[model samples]
Target chain A: MIEFKNVSKVYPNGVKALNNINLFIDKGEFLVIIGLSGAGKSTLLRLINQLIPVSTGQVIVDGVRMDTASGKILRNMRRKIGMIFQSFNIVKRMSVLSNVLSGRVGYHPTWRNVLGIYPEDDKQIAYKALQRVDILEKVHNRASDLSGGQQQRVAIARALAQQPLIMLADEPVASLDPITTVQVMDFLKEICASDGITTVANLHHVDLAWKYATRVVGVRAGEIVYDQRPSQTTKNQFIKDMEIVYGRPIHHDEFVIEEAVV
Target chain B: MSDRIIVPPPKRLGQTLGILTVILVIVASAIFARFNIIEVILGLQRGGRILARMFPLPGWFGPLMETLQMAVTGTFWGALLAFPIAILSARNIVDVPWIRVPLRFFLNILRTIPAMVFAAMFVAIFGIGNFSGVIALVIFSFGLVAKLLFESIEAIDEGQVEALRSLGADTLTVIRYAVLPQILPQYISYTLYAFEINVRSAAVLGYVGAGGIGQLFERALAWRRFHEVGELVIVSFVVVLFLDFFSAKVRRSLI
Candidate 1:
């Protein structure tokens, strides 16, 4: 379980990125955070892994106090949390297998990873991760040669290789086309459910959030405005209610019509 | 549309004045330095005779070959030294301001001094030999490679580094798995480019008694062996040309 108690994050420049945030995330729950461009959604995701430190209160992950973890403790904490980015941050020049194996860097000695020497089991784990993501055929190909959608799959495989308990995806599908977006999001949702890993994703698309989220948490100007499941309100009412979170009405195009998705 | 049209382009007075001032300074300096156009014409006429004597060469191959050797050896060692220093000096990689600052300061000083000056200084300390020449070239190219390479290192896509860090990889592991792979091609390209430059500079280092073909050039000049001097120049020119061609191809392939 991940719990945030009165978490307030203030940047060095004094921007209140998160304001008195109180939340709890259970294992195997797929939570999607929705907000405007500067609504502090990404900050909230980064804070979980201590990528961004909370200014006040505490972040306790799986019964360990993450805010105070240092050195080995901090690294060990980071190892169990897999995060993917909007840009699909796989090293372009490396073979897809190597990029996936890089996710295993925390488990091995520095010399072994540096020299590209890995135990057979780690290679097997990487291959399996790729296989799970359905990109095993591209394992030996350079990451750069893959298309954006394929590359994002490679990034997912890398994160899976970590065997993480929590997966944080910060706008994972923002850069992808609509079709690729649906495919990647589906893959992510299926993997999280099967592995029983809690996932927190920041998504600007209301329809995607509504479709994929088991529960949706709304953040606006760095504070939680609405937190509920899809069943709490009908799709139409929730769409109208999202105005308070966005400070404006949702556009017609923004609505994820069931037909478009189907 | 009228409101948009009302806005005028920025004035060119400052730019025009700046261009005019640069031209004025160049002209003034040329006049102040005697602007000897006639002397240059007459000097080229004399230079033609010297070029003419260089054909049907005699005993010029040995020292010319030695000079080529010095550049190759020096560039090899210098490039090796440059790799770590380049990594350390890149501000993006080394978070500590103290380390990058002092290292850049030293690199600046090294770069400011020419390769020939290094050869001269080393010759005074090590005496006339290929050792001094090679050492001088090493220091010279080390600075060149480090300066060029650190900038490329800094320009690398930092997203890969952050990804490695997110995976719980430490600093050195981040460099090996993340930074090195991205910058390796650029680093090799810079080293090859430095070698191309070093070969040309190495041919001149013999004037300072730092060894190689420069010593032969100096000896032939002293004895008025104009033909021999011509031979050395041709050999040196061809060797430099060949090295430039070879290294350029290597750099192109590397990048």
Candidate 2:
């Protein structure tokens, strides 16, 4: 479980990224955040992992205060919170197996990790993670040799190797094709659902957010404008409310509509 | 329709002033240095006579090999030492100004001391040997490789570093997994470049009695043995050319 208590973030250059954000995320919930670029969605997600320190308020994750956490305590806390990025962030020159194995670096001694000597158990975990993401066949291949979609899957595998209690995704599918987007989102949803992982993702697609999110939270200008579940609101009502979140009517391109294959 | 032609763009006052300033600086420098065209012509004629005397190239096998050995040994140790120094100096790797800034300043100071000067100093201390020559090349190569490597490290994809940190990877672990892979090719290329430069400098290091073909050159020139000096030049030139070509090919494949 995660809790943001009156959380607010202001950059050094006087940009207010988040304002008085109070949100609670429960375990096993696929929570999707939707907003335009620079809407504080990224700042909010990064606060949970302590990548970006909050300007004010407390972010408590599983009873530890992320804002004030330091040294080993912070690292130990971070190891349990897995994150994936829009660019996939996998080392291109390295093998997929190596990239996945890097996820387990926090569990081992620094010297062992530096020498690239992962335990047999860690190797098993890495292989299983790659298997889960259906990239086990390309384990030995250089990550740069893979397509964008495959690279993202490898990144997911890398995060999965952590066996995390929580998963954070920052625009995970912004660079993928429509079909690959659905495929990747499906894998993410299914894995998180089965594993009972707390998932917080920032999505660009309005329709995908509706389809996948157990709870959808809409943000606008550093404020949470809408939060609802499908069972609590009709699809038409959700679309209508999204207008305020986007500050305009949702455009057609905001949704991923898969084209018919020839 | 009027027949209008495109005209050449007029030069701005700043551009014109800059060109004039450059020309004025060159002229002033030439005058200050007392550059003489007649003296240069006379020097060229003397150079041709020296060239005529340097014929039937003497055996240069031993000293050439010694020069190459120094380059190889120096580059190996220097580049190895450069790895840590570069990592410490890189802005992305070591964020603290106290550590990064001072390390960079030290590297700058090291680079400012030419290899020849380093050789001369080492020769004075170590008493004129290949050991001194090797030490000079090592220090020179370390400075060059570290400077280039730190720059490369700073320019790496920061997102990978962020990803590593988010996964709770320690600083060293982050460097190993994220930073090292990205820059390994560039690192190797830089080492090869340093080695190529070291080979040339190693040949000259013997001039300061630091051991190599340069010592042979000095001895031959002092004894008025122009043919032996010519042989050394020819051999060193061929070896340097071959090394540059080979290293360039290897460097190209790496990146």
lDDT of 2 by residue, B1-255 (tens): 132322223346669989999999998998899998789899999998888688643456678888999999999999999999899898887788898888889999999999999999988898889999999999999999999999999999999999999999889999999999999999999999999999999989989999988988999999999987787788888889999999999999998
Runs off by more than 4 Å, candidate 1: A256-262, B1-58
Per-candidate Cα lDDT values, in order, are 0.88, 0.90
Model 2 chain A poorest ten-residue lDDT run: A253-262
Q: lDDT per residue, candidate 2, A42-111, as tens digits?
A: 9999999999999999999999999999889999989999999999999998988899999998898899
RMSD of each: 17.7, 18.3
TM-score of each: 0.86, 0.87
Which clashing pairs does model 1 show?
A: B54-B230
Winner by lDDT: 2
Off by over 4 Å in 2: A258-262, B1-59
DockQ of 2: 0.28
For model 2 the local lDDT of residue B30 reads: 84
